[model samples]
Target: MELDRSGRVLAALSVAPALAMAGWLMAGLPLLLLGRFAPLPMLLLGVPAAALLCWAGTRQAGKVVEATVWQVAGVVAVAAASAVFNGVMHSEQLIVRRDPATYAQYAAWIAGHGGLPISVQPEAFGGADPWLLFEGVGFYGVDGGVAPQFMPGAPMMFALGHWLGVPFAVPAVLGGLAVLTVAGVVARLAGARWAVLAALTFAVSMPILYTSRTTFSEIPSLILLFGGLALAHDALGRPGWGRGLLAGLVFGLAVLVRVDGLRDVLPVLAFAGLLIAMRRSSRSTGSARPYGALGLPLAAGLVAGAGLGMLAAYLLARPYLSYLSSSVRPLLFICGGVLLLTLAGTAAAPMLSRIRLPRWAPAVGAGLVVLLMAALYVRPWLQTVTRDPVTPEDRRTFAMIESIQRANGMPADGRLLYFENSLHWVIWYVGLPVVVLATIAAAVLVRRLLRDGTPFDWLLPLAVIGWTTVTTLLRPEITPDHPWAARRLVPIVIPGLILLAAYALSRLRTRRWWVTAAAVLVVLVPPAVTSIGTAFTPVERGEAAAVEAMCAELPPDASVLVVERVTGDRFTQLVRGMCDRPAAEVKRAGAETAPEAEVRRLIERVRAAGRVPVVLAAAPGQVAPYGPATHVIALVTRQDERSLVDAPNGTWGLGIDVWMAVAR
Candidate 1:
C-alpha cells in the first residue's frame, strides 16, 4: 500500500510521540531495577531502545509510506513550537505549591541520588513526623524517616529533566507530544484536515496548557495513555503480536505513571477482550483473520503486559503504601486476579463465540455490568456527601476550601453542590459553545456505534469517553478548586472532546470552503485565545527567591519548624527539599494559638541536639509570642493568581516570615 503526503505526515506524528513515551518508560525500568535512576544512562540507553522498537514495528508493514520532506518537517516544527510555548508558560521557578513541591522534592531526590531516599528529616513539630502521616508535607513518615507519598511516574520523568538541568522539560515535551498524539489519532480515525484541527484544539485548551506547564502528573499520564491508545488501535488494525505487546506495554507504563490510570484503561481491557472473542469466532471459517497467526498470542500479550506493568508499579510504590497504612498484598491479589480472569476469558473465547446471542447482547450486558459496578463504587460516596457527616478527608479538603472562600470573601457554607459542576467545568476553560458542539458530536458517535456494530475503531474511544465522563462527574471528593479539578479530565475529557469535535467537523460534507472555515473558527478560536493568553501570563514569582534567601540565612545545622496558621502549613516539603533543611509543621489543627510550650520543647530539643532552630510562619503573628529574644526575617513569595480561584489565597506560594529566638 502507498500513502499520500498527509497520511505520511500523520504516520510520522504518530511515530514520534510513541517513541518518546516508550523511551521514557524503558529508560526508567532499568534504573528502577538497579535502584538508581540516572538520567544520562536512561537517555543513552532509552533512545536506541525506542528507535529499535519503532523500526521493528514499522518494518513489516510492507508499505511504501512516504511523505514530502516538507510534511515531515512541518510535524517536527509544530511539535517544537508547542514545546517551546508550553515551557514558557510553565512555573518560573522551583514550585512551592503543596503537591508540585512534593513531586519536585521527589524529582530532586531521584536526580541527586539516583534512587529513592531512605528517609527525610523528622518534622520539627510536636507530633511524630508529619511526613509519616502524609500530612503537612507531601511525604509519608515511616519508621522515623520520610518518603514521598506520590507515584514514581511523573517524578521519574522530572528526574530525567533535572539531570538535563531543566526539571520542567519532561512535562513540556510530553505536553507537546500529547497534542501531536491527538492529531495523529484524529488523522487516523478521521482525516488529515481533522487531525490538524484536533491538534490545534488540544494545544490551546486551558486544561492542557495548565497541566502541561506544571509538575502535575496528568501531563505525563496523558502522554502515555494517549500514546498507548494510538498504538493499540494500530495493533488491532494489523494482526501482529509485536504491536499488541508494545501497546500493552505502553498501557502498563501509563498505569505506573498514575494508579488511577487503571480505571482510565478499563475500556482498553474490554476492547482487547472483544477483539480476542471476534478472532476466536472467525477462526472457524478458515479465513484470513486480521490478527494473523499470532492473534491469540497478541491478545494474551496485552493482558499479561498490563498486569505485569501494574505489578511493577505496585512494587515500586511499596514505600508509599506503607505510609498509607495499606498493604501490597491486596494489590498483588487484584493484579493476579485480573490476569487470571483475562487469560481464562481468552481461553474460553472459542467456546463462548459458538453460543448464539442477539446482536445487541454484548453491549447491553456490558452496560448493565458497568452501571452496577459504578453504583457499588458510588453508593458510600453519595451517602457521605448527602446523608452522613463529613469524613476526615472531606473535612480537611473543606477546611482548605473554606479558608480560600474566606480569603476571597465568598460565602461560607454554600450549597453542597456549589462546585458540583465538576462535570461541566470544562466549559469554563474551553468555553461553553465548544462544549455543546463536542457533546453533540459525542452523542452522534454513540448513536452510530450502537446502531452499527461496535467496530474496534470506535469501541475504545467510546468506552474511554463514557467511563471517564461518568467517573469524573461522580467523583465523590470535595471538588477541588475549579480549573485544578479539571486536571483530572485532561487525560480523557479534553482529548476525547477534541476528537469528537474533529469527527463532527469532518462529517460536515459541506463543499463550501467559507462554511468549513467558519465552523472551524467557531469551535477553536475562543479557548485557544484564553489558553494562549493564560500561557503568556507569569505566575509564582519570588517563591524560589524567598525560599533561597531563607535557606541562605539559616545556619547549616539549623532545623526548621513551619507553623501552620491561616494557611494550614503545606510548606514543610518545600523547606525540606528546596532548602535542604530538616523541617516539620507545628500541629495547630483547630487550635486558637501556637502551642507555645510544645514549640519551646521542640526548640530546646533541637538546641540540645546541637542544631539551631528556626520557626517559619505564614502569618507573622504566629511567631509573635517569642518576643524580644526572637529575630525575624521577612520572606515574600508571589503566587499564580489563577490558583486562588479554586484554592485558598494562601495555598499558592506566599510571602512568609521566619523567626528564631536567641538564647540569652
Candidate 2:
C-alpha cells in the first residue's frame, strides 16, 4: 500500500501548485463577490478542498506514471531547502516605489479588510483640498475611491501570506512549488532522469531567486503556468475530462496572477482548436477520437477562468485596466479572432485533414525557427530599438536610463532601448549552452510537430512557451536594467529554455554520455555563478523595522500628511496600509518644496475633523515648524543596482529617515 500510494502522491504533487491556487480562488472569489473576503476561511477551507480534489483526480488517473520515488523525493528536498533559504533572504519591500511594494500594500489591505476599492477616507482631511492628493504613487484614485495599480490576482494570493503574518513565506513556498512543477514537466516530457537537474538549474537561476524572495507576481504566475502544463500533459493519457478542465482553468487563471498571462496562454486556445480539428478529422476517418471530450472541456475551462480574470480586472482594478487599455484591447480582439477561427477549422476538419502537404514542410518549418533565432542574434548590429518619450512614464524611464548610463560610464542616450540585445539577456542568465540546446530542441520539436503530428501534449506547452518567449525578447519594453528587466524573462523565457535544454540533453545521452554531462555543467554553471553575488545578502534589510518604528510614532487616529517629495512617494501606501492610518502626500509643482501656508491649511482641516494631524518629512527641520519634531525612523539598506550594459554585479546603498510631529 505504501508503494502504491507513492505514485499517486507524486502525481498529486505535480499539480499541487495549481490545485492550491485554484482552491484559494475558489474560496476567495465567492467571498469577494459577497463583499466578505477573508483569509481564515480561504486557508482552512480552500486549501483542503483543493487537496481533496487533486487526490481524487490522481486516483482517477489509473496507474499514473511518475518519476522514481527517489527522484520525486529529491525534487521535494531541493524545494524545501530553497524555501528556507529564500525566506531568510527575502527583501522587505513594505513601502511603495515599485511593483514589489505595490503588491505588498495591496495584499496588506486585503488581509486586513475584505473588500474592493480601498477608500481614501477623504473626510479624514475634512474633504479633499487641492493640496491633499489622495492618490499615491501606486494607488490610483478611481470612482471617488483608491485602487491598486495592478491586477488583483497576485495581491489576492499574497493576502493569504498576509493572514499568516509572514508575507514573504507565500512567495518562497510558491517558488518551491514552481520548481517541483517545472521538474515534473521535464520528467514527463524530457525523461525522469532529467527531473532533478531541471529542478536544480531552475532554482539556482538569479531571476527565480530574486523574484521568489520578493512579493513579485512572476513566481505565482510561473507556478500556475507550468502546473497547467503538467495537468494538461496528464489529461492526454487519462480517459476523463477532470485533468483537462483543471489544466485549462489553471492556465487561464494565470492572467489573474499577471495580466500578461492572457498573452502567455494564447497558444493554449490555439492548441485546443487544433485538438478539436484533429478529433473531428479522426471521426470522419473512423479513427480513435483521442482528445475528443478533453478538447471541448479544456476550451470551456480556459474561457471560464480567463473570463473571471477580466471580470475581476474590470470591477476591482478598473484604473489599471484603463491604463492597459491599449494592449489589453488588442489582446482581447486576438483571442476573439482565434476562437472564431478555431470554431471554423473544427467545422471544416474533415476537409482539411484530407488535404496532404509536401514532405519538405517539417524541415522548412524547423529551418525557419533557426533562421528567426539567427536574425534576432544579428539584430543588434543592424538596428537599435528606441522610443520617443511621449508619456510621463516614458520620460521617467528616460531619466532612469540616463542615470544608469552616466553611472556606468556609457554614452548618455536615454532613448536607447537595447532590446535588440534581448537574446544576449537570455544568454547572460542561462548561458550559451542553454541557448544552443534550446534552439536545437525547438527546431527538432517543430519538425516533429509538423510531420508526425503526435506527442499531442507538447503542442500547447511548446506553443505557449515559444510564442511568449520570442515576443518578449523582441520587445521587453522595460527599464532595460538587470534583474529589474529580467522579470520579463523569468516568467516564461528562462524556464521554457531550460526545459528544452533538458530535453535536448536527454535525447543526446544515448549517443554520448559525456556530452550530456558536460552540457549540463555548462548550462547550470553560468546561472549559479551569476546568483552568488547577492543571494545570501538580502536587499532592503531593516526596512520592516524602520517602518514599524515609524508607525509607532503616529497616533492610531492620526491623519498623516507627508511634506517631502521622496518621503511622500515612498510612504504614502506604507502609512495607509502598515500604519493603519489615513495618509496623503501634499501635491506640489515639479521639484518644488511643499508650500507652508497650504500645508498649514491642510493640518487645520484634519484637526477640525476630530483626527490628530501628524506631519512627516525626511528631515526634522521640515516638520519642526508645525510642532516639536521627533525622529522616528532611521534606516540604512542596500538595493539592487541598475545594470544596463552587462549583468548586474553589486548593490547600491540606500538611506531613509523620517521625522514626525503632531500639529497643536
Best by lDDT: 2
Residue-level lDDT of model 2, residues 161-244, one tens digit each, is 777788878888878888888887887788767778888888988888889998999988898898888788888887356777
TM-score of each: 0.82, 0.96
Model 1 misplaced regions, further than 4 Å: 1-6, 57-78, 92-96, 121-135, 292-309, 316-348, 351-389, 404-410, 414-420, 431-455, 476-478, 529-533, 563-568, 586-594, 619-656, 659-664
Give a tens-digit lDDT track for model 1, residues 585-659. 667655744577776777777676777777666455666555333434364544544232332122244565555
Global local distance difference test of model 1? 0.62
Among the numbered candidates, top TM-score falls to: 2
Between which residue pairs do clashes occur in model 1?
120-146, 124-584, 131-140, 131-141, 132-141, 239-291, 404-648, 637-655
Native-vs-model 2 lDDT?
Answer: 0.83
In model 2, which regions exceed 4 Å deviation?
1-8, 43-45, 511-516
TM-score of 2: 0.96
